[model samples]
Target: MALNFYGLDLIVASNIGTIKHVKYNSNPNKKPDIKQLQRIKELEKGQGITCMTWADAEQTKFIVGRKDRTVQTFNLITDEFSDTKSVDFGEGKLQSVSVFGESIFGAVESGVIKIWKSNTSDEHLLNTGGPIEKMKHCSYNSSIIATGGKENDLKLWDLEKRTTTFHAKNVPHDWLQLRVPIWVSDICFLPENNGNVVAVCSRYGAVRLYDARAQRRPVCNVDFKDQAGSCISLGHYDKHVIVGTGRGLLNLVDLRKKGKLSKSYKGAVGAITDVMSQKDANVVVSTSLDRHLRIHNAESKEIILKQYLTSKLTCFLLRTVDSFIKQEDGEITIKQEIDDSEIKDEDEPDQEYDEMFDNMEIIREGISSKIEKNIFLEDKTKDVTVSKKKMKSEAKKRKGNDTINDASISEDLIDSPKKAKLDKEEEKVNDEDIDQSIIKLLRSTEKLKRKLLSKNKKKKAKSLFYK
Candidate 1:
């Protein structure tokens, strides 16, 4: 259900089966030793890893929501499993579970949300409402929960009050018999703010920021050209807000400057299943249905690292903490054995590293040709400088021609035949000049094409010589 990466260790949540201990940076394709594979096989049985969270380095707790509407919690430190606790909610499966302080919240399929106090018996905080699609805790306080549901509504709930604090509704209307409406996909609270403003995304390709304290209206909405998929994840660092949509698109929006999308990264071939931001905010890791985990520089939107996986990663968590040891003799000792099976082989070397560096010279000649191709494909209307220069040149030519025509007409007005002959000659010359201008433009384009071809041929020759 979830994989939590802490330092160099990977804590996997196997809902009902045993938890897997894997190296954080290991490769999935690498073969494990006999004993390690056997251990992994044991953990892969039954309902599989459900959901796991680290209570500490020595302890972890995971909940397995079984098909029979039962939940079981396993303590990894004690190796003791709790008795199966049957969920009182009618015959629906548990969709998601979250732990906050001393409480656990479960979103069930029966359109009901249940809460249980960890210290007390497995009882519900409020057995109200239908199934919630997604739920998240406000970063500022764990007591507040944000829920989105099938009804296309976002509700803010206060645990202490045990009631709804604020609700935003999406209503449908019919104009000319067209039913148009909005549906909430995901919601997140901005960092450092006490749930004062929340960013909500919808399936209709719009992301909106709402102020809970203000009237029931959105502060700003951003519309994208593509239809966003179901999942929407948000990460905030300083004034930058990183948003990931289900359509495998990543956007960085600056809160300080409204209505501006600063950077975007496009790499995921399929829907993005989850996104986890590093504590430093410079790097963000995302998993998609394409079975790849990609790391991107949040500021530059460039891919730094990409790891291929065997399975689609559903959820992931990252945390930074102190190293798990004290410096006694200027050395750090780890109690657990290092699992080297996870480190994958680097992509096959096409050539020796030094040889490849030397061979890169072949691409240098081709770069200019590629650049020209890109420029030609780009929107010409956006070339402000070129358009301005063309306009100025045309204006000066028009002024000179007007003065010439005026002087010729004034001097030849007395003689009708001579004036008529002069007029005809001038018209022919004017037409020739117009034709030459058109021909000159065409020839310039042809010259660029020939230059591009020459550069490409040289690059090809260089490539073959290197081979």
Candidate 2:
């Protein structure tokens, strides 16, 4: 009630007088989140809230009815309670509240309607009954109201005329020809219906739509399977009304003439206490004794948001406009819901980022694939050694060459056995300056062998031995 919602917009009140504002997630895959929560400090330990309604369209002021048998006016702007329009009914708790024609009305379960800001001496209007279960102020006509309760059938009242305009008769009979006891738990006036069409839910799981201008009995009748229907709500464009049951069931029911029931929204684990639908969208919200507030996409029958409020939610109000509702100036308007498939592309890639990606270099191959081309797998890896047979073959071919010296051929032959395992770089020694003496030849051979042994230690010392 904290300037939270004007209707189907936001703000839920729990049994302990705590108000919470929640935001809906249009994506069914993600959960809804709670935005704010506040407890009414003035409400004491023993009091119980029975009713809540916006006192003005600006959402600056609101009304609260408590089990203490008092109806109080609260100001959202000042965040305080005012005594000007507050009233102590002195009996039963108020079940319904309405602000219309510049007067405030508090209707009690005892069939008494207390009118504030009245010019007449008689401030309280009485129905010819002792108790009423539910009462709804007509949306299309502020002067008209609808009421129903235990043993009391649905009735429409004209506040200006101070008379009952229509009374609904009991359902004719069952297949067994027995009576269907009356126990209407909640009533909702259909939008744009001139206050003549209403949707009602009974404690016996019956959902009935009444067209006052057409007939006294219900025009369309449907039963909620295995769950007692407790509350109902209608939206501006909805061909159906969302119904809440005593056992935590919420579903849209096509209750017009030639209508059928819609799919069920699954989540709550306790009795549903209240339900509301956004006027312009297929978004519906419900509260249950399970302490959870759930919003559903009525068209797809999916839950858009589910938030735990930490208290048994009894009732809530929301605006049909966006979350930034101008609650203080007039009725807070809630924004329309966006479907998941039709969500805006707000998360699209940035233009600069796309340009950077397009400008990046594209490599033909990865480094891993070229591990052996210009790179080696390990640091210890070396080239393949030349075969000893290949060295002998090359030396034989060079010995037969025309410009070779006999002494040079002898030096090469002397070195071939020791240098057989050497690499090509180590085999390039210049022996053209040899003296051709046997002692000199043996000395040169020893020097060449020592140098080759020091350079390529990978070949064992014995492999370089002169045989």
Candidate 3:
């Protein structure tokens, strides 16, 4: 869940417990190596590490939020640890943490958002809301913070003013009580001069672009055919916004023009739990409930690297530096792969299996009926033609026979009503005989018909074309 930048020699907080040190190389020309640089020592006791924020450039000092409702600081240079400094905010758990300059901000489970300065004093600058679901620092302006949660409310707060700058309300409320809150999944400010623009995604499969400077509503919105599960995680690199959904889909939104879907990558087989962008912005990494860590090239949508992990990653942060570190001997050790085998198996019964079987049965029955109808129609046509030819030949034969026989015999044969009735009955019998033959063939060769039908299906499939 943590992103390590080799260039900056920094490792941000990830959800895999406490990973205080990273092994890396110093020189690009030499073989890769590992260095045991320790950042936090107290994390060895299995204290829950929920979120991390770097306070300095060297990444020597940082703050981490733990499950015990405490925030602790660690200094890498001195290899020292500080005990939790409790901030009184009722009883809700802290879900997210961020740093803007010397001030620190945390979003709690009770929907309350709080901020404190770097001096580590008992005083806090701002404490707002009951508990915040998600929070992020504004990219362009460090003074602004965006917060959202179960209430479907998005608030933009200005640290200087100590108040909300803009409050956007009435977000979709469906699925709010779901496993993952269906409110605002994630909100991110675009990079560079596009500070006024922000993208917000909801759990109801909606991605909307809003202009903070505009007086009206959002400029554009997309629903992805209403299939994007829930927008749980989001990242921004230049003009593109990458969104991770509950269904484990990584969607790329192009904001350069009006908002448009550029591409979508299969993030993982399970729900996407977290996503991070590398310092280069050309690549993105995501973690899923499927216990997979996937890295993708932003432009090509090609997976550059995929590693299986044992645990479901809950959160991830990328250090804003290259992934290479230098050593005295000019050796480099690439970032160590995270082992995610800690995730337990939680497969549930598939609910769609019965419906799928029913659909298949219906299709099979339709095909069988169509085949029977076609065979019956073809036999009836052939029998009618054969009967007409036979009748014409018998009439010609009778005429020739009569011309050679005596005139009295011909008159007697013509006057015989019983014979005429018998001829009519014979025609009816022939019709019934043809129908019985067709029925017998259909019943006796059912298995053969099935085989032929299968073969015809294969042939038709081969002839079908798909774009």
Q: Which candidate comes out best when scored by lDDT?
A: 2
Which candidate leads in TM-score?
2
- Model 3, 1-467: lDDT tens digits are 23343321333243535432322222344322212223233345445566676765545566778776678776654656653576567556677777767767787777666677756763454555644667777767888887776654567788777787776644344466534233676777766533566677777676776667773355666666655544433444456677788778888777665677777888488887767665444567776777666778766888765644334455544455433332336654444433324323222212233455667733455557567867866775676567657756765676566456535466778678986687668667766765676566555556555776797787678884621
lDDT of 1: 0.58
| Model 2 per-residue lDDT tens digits across residues 392-442 | 566556645523543456666547765444433333441222223334545
- In terms of TM-score, how similar is model 3 to the real structure? 0.57
Q: Point out the higher-scoring one by lDDT: 1 or 2.
A: 2
For TM-score, candidate 1 versus 2, the one ahead is: 2
Query: What is the overall TM-score of model 2 with all chains considered together?
Result: 0.63
lDDT head-to-head 2 vs 3, winner: 2
The runs of at least 3 residues in candidate 3 whose Cα sits more than 4 Å from the true structure, single-residue gaps closed, are 1-16, 20-47, 76-83, 118-122, 125-131, 169-182, 193-195, 225-238, 256-258, 279-281, 322-467
Ranking by lDDT: 2, 3, 1
Worst 10 residues of 2 by lDDT: 377-386
What order do you get sorting by TM-score, best first?
2, 1, 3
